[model samples]
Each structure stands twice: as structure tokens, then as C-alpha cells.
Target: MAPSRWDRLPGGRLLGGLLALGLLAGCGHDAVRRAPPRSASTRAWPTVAPADPASANAVLMRALGLVGTPYRYGGNTPEGGFDCSGLVNYVYRDMLDLRLPRSSRDLAAMQGPRIPEDRLATADLVFFGSAGAVSHVGIYVGEGRFVHAPSTGGTVRLDRLDGPYWRDHYSGAKRVLH
Candidate 1:
């Protein structure tokens, strides 16, 4: 029998072979690099921009179009429904041609620097409190509000960031579009 195509990747087989040695090597330094977030406001993905609110507003409006759509876990389209992260993922993709992580954990890990809460722009990402960890995220709209899928009974809407629930659990914010 001939070797399969999977065997052609240079390091694929050799990578697995090194697992036992990697464990024995005690990769503690790298382990610490993956430490759990300790604060509510950790970081927001940082990037350079020329300060464009018009683009931001257009993106926010596009996101608002999907409000009142049903919430379907793991959904990523308006035809079916959307969860929190799914909504953000779709909006950024559709409006600004940007892609976002599919889950809140991956989204949260994207933090680099924080944008001021009051200065929110379109296509910015906002993190909400986790039940036990980061369980929710949304796209920020202007005026201290954000559009999100929220929970079981709620439809996506522009919510005040200072609300007791969101305020207490505001993890951080990031700008990803424009």
C-alpha cells in the first residue's frame, strides 16, 4: 500500500511523536502565558485607525438590521438566527469586511488595548460578564448603547452600557472595523 496524502506534510507525523518529550520538558513558561483573565476590564484588540465615525456609524446601522432576529445557538446568519458572538461575527463580516472569532473566549483573547467606553464607534466589540467566565459579546452602537442578541427572552437591541447588569460585568471593548 502507498503512504496516504496525510503523510506528506513534513512535520505532521513528527509533531505527534514529540508530544511525550514535550510533556516531559514541562512547558510551564508557556502555561503561564495562557493564564485566566483576572479583571473584568482586561484588554480590547488594539489597532491603528484614522478616526472614522462615519464608517463606524454605517457599520452599526448594518448590525441593527438584524435586531429582532431569533437567537439560535451557534447560528451565524440572519436567515436562521444568531447568538451574541454569531451576531458580531456576521455584522463585521457583512458591513466592514472584517472577521471576528466565533466564540466569546476567542473574541476576548483578542484584546490588545482599550477604547474608551464613552467613545464607542461602529463595528466595535463589547464583552459582557460571564456566568462563570466570558459568556457573551456584542457589537457596540454609538450613544452608550450596544446591539446584542442578549438572552433567551430578549431580542437584539441598543442597550445602555451603564445598565446595572452590563455595567457590573463590562469586561472590555475593542474596535475592529475601519
Candidate 2:
């Protein structure tokens, strides 16, 4: 007889509970543990020149400040709230006069430096889902967390890249700023 799904797990209920709390390994499947980048500086956040709108710090701060904004599919402004891609578009356009591709898939496909997950830094655009078929994008805020307008009924918020759900779905990352 074949083993049940639960039976295949080493600790069954204990492991299930730990996964639920993001304590144990991610999803108990193909989860890869990618650590966030660290800086030599003692600052809580990574240092970058904020004077330049193209600077990573500038972009990251702008995105972080918009947390709690309502998620609006197809919406693009703070007044109207924002969707994931809209938030990215608005930030780049408003901060640097740089207009990014409108959809998450398009943004993921845009020409830029592809960054490895372990090397992700502030303001990098992190993608989720398969390559060429990415479904979500977020602004990396260092320490393995990112800010994004996740879904309908959800507000813009920060989430861990190493967390179970995201760890399993992580596709790749890109450096939007040259």
C-alpha cells in the first residue's frame, strides 16, 4: 500500500503546524532557503544615495511609505489605491519619470539586470511564478522582505521572501535601476 501524504511527512501534525507558522521548512516540498543580503554598514537599512530618484534607497523608501494603501486592480494612484504593477509603475514614473511596463508579466520581461535571489538588494523587483509567466512583482526592502499590493481585499504590505508561500512561488528578481 502507498503511504498517505501526511504519512510521508516525518513529523506529521507537528511539521504541519510548524509549516503553518512559517517555522519549519517551506511547504515541505522543493523549498529553497535563500538568505537576504547583508550590508557592512551598521544602519538598519542598506545605504544608497536617495538624492537620485534612480537610486535603490529612494525607490525602496517610496514603496515602503505606501504600505496599507488599498489594493485596486487596474488602479494606479494613491487616491484610487493601487494594484501590484500599478504601484511599481507609479513609483518609477513619479520618482524617476521612468515608465515601467504596465503588467507584472511585462515588468518581469522588461530589459534589465537579472539578479539572483540571494543577491537581492533594496528596490529590486522580485517576481513570483515561472519565468516568462510571472504573476506577481514586489519591491525588495532588504532583509528578505518585500512590499507589494498582494490581492483584492488585501492592502499593500511587506512579506518575507523566505516564507513558505513566497519561497515556493519565487521565480526570480530584477534590478530595475541601473
Candidate 3:
């Protein structure tokens, strides 16, 4: 038979055949193996159950949409701008109809499960502080990132949780949404 179309392409016949074979081989029951669970000491961070996707997505979308809105101390609404906690408050309230404490310190002390850094899910509140006093807060938006209104002359923005200043000041996180 004449060389097939796949054979006409450089290495296509051989590569395609090999890829097909590999995929077929991987379908066998024994082809899959789960890695052994890591011991607590060896684990980098603990995991937690994910938050409700609908609520989390709504909160995240609302928070992200406000990015670049100017920061105003004690401001809460989009029209008025926002402070750190005010941004968080507006997001949760706007998206989930959930009222939260207006100040970061109060929000930190509000009732909720404290989530570790690695366990944070979308919409979880990440806190920052010094001398054991919680002073700033932001909404966790997955991928070690968060959204907040940073400071005077700044605007709502996304920042990395692992950033030097944030990492050093990270007090803890709290899950307000189930």
C-alpha cells in the first residue's frame, strides 16, 4: 500500500503509533498507582475541604472586579472606594449577602474556623498584623494570591500571600463562608 498520510509527515507514523500504544498501555487497571500519603512531619502544609464553589466564585469575581478602585480609609462601597477590610467586607456582603465586621481586627476575632495558609480556599479571609494585633485583611483568591485595597494613594489590587511583607505579617486566615 502507498505510504499513509501519517507516514508522509516526518516521524509522524512512528511517534503517533508510540503515543497510541502508550495511552492504551496506561488503561490497564494496574497501570495506575497512588503515591503513599506523606507523614505529618514531611507534609509542607495541611489541606482542608474546599469552600462552596458558587459562593466562593461570586466573592472572588466581585472582589476581582473592584481591582483599581481607589483606596479610601474606612470606605466600603465601590463608589466610595475601600480600605483593606472594607474591600473584604464589600465583597462578601455584595456577593454572598454576608455581613462581616468592618475592621480587620474585629473580622479576625469573629467566629469562624481558623484556616492555615496552605488550607486557605477562595473567599477565606487572610489577616496581617504586628505585635499580635490583627490590623489588615484580604480575601484569598486561590494560588497563594489575594485581593485587597492596600494603602493611601493605592487602589484595590491583587498580591501574593508569599510576598515578603505579607508573608512576614500573615497572622492567620478565617473561613466565613461554609
Top candidate, metric TM-score? 3
Per-residue lDDT tens digits of candidate 1, residues 53-140? 6677677778888879988887889987888988888887887677767898788788555667655665678887756478789877
For model 3, the stretches where C-alpha displacement exceeds 4 angstroms are 1-49
* Lowest lDDT block of 10, candidate 3: 39-48
* Candidate 3 C-alpha lDDT tens digits along 32-142: 565456543343433344658888888889999999999999999999999999898888887878888889999999987898777888888999999999989999887
Off by over 4 Å in 2: 1-54, 130-132
TM-score per candidate, chains pooled:
0.65, 0.69, 0.73
Ranking by lDDT: 3, 2, 1
Residue by residue across 112-178, what tens digits does model 2's lDDT show?
A: 7788766777788999985447999999888778999999999999998877788789899888776
**Number of the predicted model whose lDDT against the real structure is largest:** 3
The C-alpha local distance difference test score for the whole of candidate 2 amounts to 0.81
Q: Is candidate 1 or candidate 2 better by lDDT?
A: 2
Q: In candidate 3, how many Å is residue 85 off?
A: 1.2
lDDT values of the candidates?
0.74, 0.81, 0.86
- Residue pairs clashing, model 1: 44-112
